[model samples]
Structure formats: C-alpha cells, structure tokens
Target: MNLENKYYINNSDLKITLEELKDKGIIYIENIQRGFSKYPNLIIEGSEEYVNNAVKQLVAANGIENSYADFYYGRLDEDEKNKVKEALNEREIVIVESLQLSKDDIFVHLNDELLEILLKLTSKEVLFSTFYFTKYPTLVWGNYGRRYPVFFKDEFVMETVKEQIWV
Candidate 1:
C-alpha cells in the first residue's frame, strides 16, 4: 500500500442517495473520454504510519471514529441481494441522455445490471464496497471509500441500513 496516499474519516450526516448514499448507487465516474483526473496531493514519506497513528488517536475519541463498522447486508440472507437489486431497479437510470455533466463530478448510472457488480466486491483492502447501504452515515464508509468511491440507490434500501456507526 502507498502510505503517501491521503486517508480520511467522515463524521457528518450524509444526505445523498446510494451511489455513495450520502448519495445513491453510484459509479463515481467522470467524462473518461476527456481524461479527467483526481486532484494531486502532497505525498510525504511514511505518511501511512502517521495516518495510522492519527487514526488511532481519532478512534480514542468516542463517536469520532467508528472503529467497528459493518453493513447491514450481513443480517439479510437471500433478501440482501434482493434489497440491493430492488434499490437499483427503482433508481434506474442511464447517462446517455443529454445530462450536462461537470468535469469534476462523478457520473453514476444505476440499474438492474448493477446488482451483479455490487456482489463481486470482496477485497478486504477495498477502498469502498456496497456496505454504504448500512446504517452508518456516508462519512463512516468514506473513511476509505473516498479513494475508490462506489455508490448505490437512495431510500430503496434504507430499511436495512443503520443510521449510526458501530463500536
């Protein structure tokens, strides 16, 4: 892992739908054809160690950092997939239309096809997963999700999500 890369933890309430549900089922896209890129940042040596220590300090503060965060999907059996699927279907959209997209904005397309992609995320080191559907605020998931943001539909799966962070 590149320690120099920035890491953050969010503690604010999110109002967006799933695609980030602080926003909804999102693809975090840009105009790929235009070669839009992420903002450059200072990469100090040994930053990961520093960030880890800082993260530890943050965790020491109650309700500041959610050290124990997990999604509600684990609670549902077959219904888990269905819940996500239903959210996608209801938030159905295609970006082909004449939607004016900002250069810095992430372009997300929600639909039934997203169900399969959402289930394939398994990397423990993943920056973001479908866990955004859980009860915690969007900031909790963005702790790592910001690096590689993924979103799902809004409201469609709020019933299965917890609004607070765990532990």
Candidate 2:
C-alpha cells in the first residue's frame, strides 16, 4: 500500500500500544525509519558487536555494504541466506538508523505473531484475523474495510533473516 496515497489517522494514545507490544516480545526502535523508508518495519536494535556481525554477514550475502542499515525485501543468495540464518540462531538484534516513529504512526500487521496482543487495544466485537489502523484511528480488521491493508504502508516482518544495526 502507498502510505502517501492513503489517509492516515494518528492514534490519540500510542503509549498503551507500545507497552502492549513490549509485553508480546516485539522489540522495536521507535521513530527510526524516516530516512530509510516512509513505512517503518519492525527493526531489531542491538549492541555494536551484534550489529556489526549482522552487517558483515549481510554484506557478504548481498555484496552491498551498508545495505543492511535499512529495511529491504530483496532476494538473497543461498550462501547469504545461510549466513543470516546462522546469525538468527544466536538470537541477535538489529536496527535501522535515522528512523523515528511517534505513537500515531505505528501500525502492526495482522499476521504478526504479536497481533493477538495488539488486538486487545481494539474492539472485542470485531473478530478480525487480519488488522490495520484506519482513518478513525481505531483498529479495524479485514482488508476490504479499510483504505489500505494491515501493514500495507509501514511494516516489516523479520523472520529468520536478521538485518540489523546499532541504536
């Protein structure tokens, strides 16, 4: 989804939402996507050592220095994939630089493992497997119900692939 095209309703209170996500095992560096991308993907912030290791592995895989400094969904070679997988096995954290987020700009994808916890902030009456923040600033489930799909504009799902940076 083009975040620029769709209307975004900033949430009145994001503190509660941030706290809730913390309770769900989602680690993020708020307001850390401004220079990289318009949408903020859930980035992993870690210590210098870990971030450096992650960068080295990513550069080896993509053959692009500093590419791991931002959020991207690019094809990785098998060797590169293995290296990233190995790093994740150690449970390292990664982050993006110059990305900043306010509570109002935050949104989570429905498929996120932490979605169940996020839904607690929304209505109990609406049973939505898929979710997104709408113009109302209320959590809405279902893609057809909103202008953009959940995690459409600002989203990143870092599975086993660990692209990271120092905070």
Candidate 3:
C-alpha cells in the first residue's frame, strides 16, 4: 500500500524525542538525519506484530519522550538503522511519499528521484507547474507550484525550512 501522509510536529518536541532516544541508546542521531535527509516523506508500513516489535525495541532502548512515534534521523544511530530496517523487512509493505513544496505562490524544486516516482504514480493527464522568484541581490529560487494529482494514504511528510531541499 502507498503510505503518503502529512503531519505537523513542533520542532522542540521532535528535538526532545531525539535526545531521549539517544540517551537510551535506541538510535544514533546521525543515522536518523541521513535517513530523513534522503527520504523526507517516508511511510513505514508494517503489520501489528512488526509495529509492536519495533516500538518495543525503541522503548527498551529508550522510553518515549513524546506521545508520538515520528522518527527523526538526528536521533538514530547505526544500530537503530539496522533494527528499523529489520523491522521494515519483516513487514508486508513499505511506501515512501515524495514531498511537494509550495510557498506564498511559489513552488520549490522537486528532487529528480522523487519526480520519477511521482511520474510512475500519476497519469499523463496531470499537469505540473513551477514558479521562479528572485529577491534583489540576495538569492533567487523556484518551487514546484502545487500539489500533484497523486495521493498517499499513510506516508509522512517532513516540513522543513522553505529554502531547504531534501534529496
């Protein structure tokens, strides 16, 4: 199944959870960062057993700091990666969502890899537009304009700074 969904979490809360995970030896922050940077909108879908096991591992390593289970890269380490991967492998399906950006009438760049995946999911009838902007001598940027026609049900989208790019 395709897991494409969006969530908004306070940055401070995310940071606290990361810190707690690190303290309990559940995950290495660096690994988590790498994963998030590489795959922002990742939908980790697993059976009840898989989810329970993964959560157990996470809790045993470190108790939950926040009530949410949103994983952050800066809080995961090598061992955590392996555990998460193992849990993912045992699951029946995993769907990753590609994030589409929009800002005050402007669209940001979409990573090529994400674009290819989106193309496969969308039909030819879908049209995409992008807008470019220049701000004095400071900088110039562009955005993907709007959301694509495709939809993701359970995926997680990480919202970052407007000027940042996730690839």
Root-mean-square deviation of each candidate, in angstroms? Answer: 18.1, 20.7, 20.3
What order do candidates take by TM-score, descending?
A: 2, 1, 3
Model 3: CA > 4 A from native: 1-11, 16-48, 66-167
For model 1, how does the per-residue alpha-carbon lDDT over 1-167 read when each residue is reduced to its tens digit? 32122222121221122344333322232332221242211111223344333223323332222222222333344554354434442222121111222332222222222222232222222222332222222212223322323222233322222222112
On TM-score, the leading prediction is 2
Residue runs of model 2 more than 4 Å from their true location after superposition: 1-37, 65-160, 163-167
* lDDT of residue 119 for candidate 3: 28
Runs with alpha carbons beyond 4 Å of true place in candidate 1: 1-47, 63-68, 72-124, 127-139, 143-167
So what's the TM-score on candidate 1?
0.20
Report residue 154 deviation for candidate 3 (angstroms).
35
Clash count in backbone of candidate 2: 10
C-alpha lDDT of all candidate models, in order: 0.27, 0.28, 0.25
lDDT by residue (44-157, candidate 2, tens digit) is 234434432433343333332111111111233456435433433121111110112232424332322123222221222122222222221111122122221212133332
Error of 2 at 117 (Å): 41
